[model samples]
Target: TPLPTSSPRSSPNILITGTPGTGKTTAAGMVADAAGLELVTVGDLIKQRNLHDGYNEEFDTYWLNEDKVVDEMEEMMAGGGMCIDFHTCGFFPERWFDLVVVLRAGTQQVYDRLKSRGYKQNKIEENLDCEIMQVVADEARESYKAEIIMELTSNTIEDMEDNVEKIVAFVNGFRSSHK
Candidate 1:
């Protein structure tokens, strides 16, 4: 699908997703602050709300209940002005978000960052492979309209700052257009 040249909606519901250790959470926080949107970190949501069906010992990850997440988020998404932050967002219904940002980083950088978090070797490798293969970007594109799906590189501070500025501009433009 062709990408739209203009912002998609006023007070848009946004999704910020990427491979692990790719600076998605940090960038999402910045975007939410700059855009005056509420941030929802899915991992935290799963833990706080116990929204998962079970835990996986091998990956040290939860088997999230997709329905529970949708049930919890549908109302907030309908109201708009929400930034959903998570590594896995493709499963979310397309109607829920107006924009989706897929953050990416160099494989080496992702490896180091995950390492700093003390992630298991297998997990770190998995993330590195995902980044290398652009899994996050692919997922976003498949789930959302091309115009609503943006790919941003966040391997450096400057890149992150630029991404935040771009998202803020998009939000402001959307608001203005609606007005």
Candidate 2:
């Protein structure tokens, strides 16, 4: 699908986020490709730029320097046509995203998904808990306007397709209004 012709002033900045194993990266890539937007993943960016503060052996995840990551991303976020994929959304400035999509999946589904990826039992359980608690969605709500925050399920291919369509329509609408 061709990208919506956004206002000359700016292109839309979209964020796709959710708990680990919730298909955030997959959906973000699909949406970005369908919408002809550029895809930027927080983890990839951090690793590429060596922006991590340190590594956490317990979680097997990097401790990113939040401020440094934000600073590095400021330019890309401002440039637009960017679909950002990440597990955390609250750290980003609200104005940076035109829309924030929070993907949800059931605890068992998340646990299964993570386990399939060789995640430790503890990590899998922790992520399942995060999903169950709606932590990411709550963070998006606190960061963005009600109209700009959308929650979608990522439990199946059909759900993901539906979410991509919804996002396209939303971007079209946002562009129309801005124009």
Candidate 3:
């Protein structure tokens, strides 16, 4: 594999996180494309990892055997330059990450998106509070040693692309400054 930056670069990793409707997947995809980095989503990976046995929905809060997926990510981290996407940043050691981008969408926007996705009232409240209180942002701050940035989305495809571009710029600047 071609190294992420041949300019005597330091390793870098990012966590693209937020509530369900906050565009974590979309932002990670676009940011990875823009930055020419690998985009890895822990939840999807975990789901696939557990597909053979198929986990119940309740396990998502804190997967019973999360270490299995985290172990894989730890191995992947050795190669560096990865954009890790997940609503909750529970697995892997915090030192592996370089930055945390907490994507946010307004209450009405999130309610609309989740409603269309068929989320029930209780689930909706959980996510709505996650956004209102900036839970992901707080989580990242609590877990990682790196700086965190917030990007607000309007629940539009264009907003995802735009914010991803902005994150790419931020990462580029971060890499440059650290050099």
- Each candidate's TM vs. the true structure? 0.93, 0.92, 0.78
**Native-referenced Cα lDDT, model 2:** 0.83
List per-prediction Cα lDDT, in the order shown.
0.85, 0.83, 0.71
lDDT of 1 by residue, 80-142 (tens): 789999998778998877778888899888988999999999999988888898888888877
RMSD, each candidate, Å? 2.3, 3.2, 4.9
Best by lDDT: 1
Instruction: List clashing residue pairs in candidate 2.
Output: none
Candidate 3 clashing pairs? none
TM-score quality measure for candidate 1: 0.93
The best-first sequence of candidates by TM-score reads 1, 2, 3
Candidate 2 TM-score, C-alpha based: 0.92
- Each candidate structure's count of clashing pairs: 0, 0, 0
Model 2 C-alpha RMSD vs. true structure (Å) is 3.2
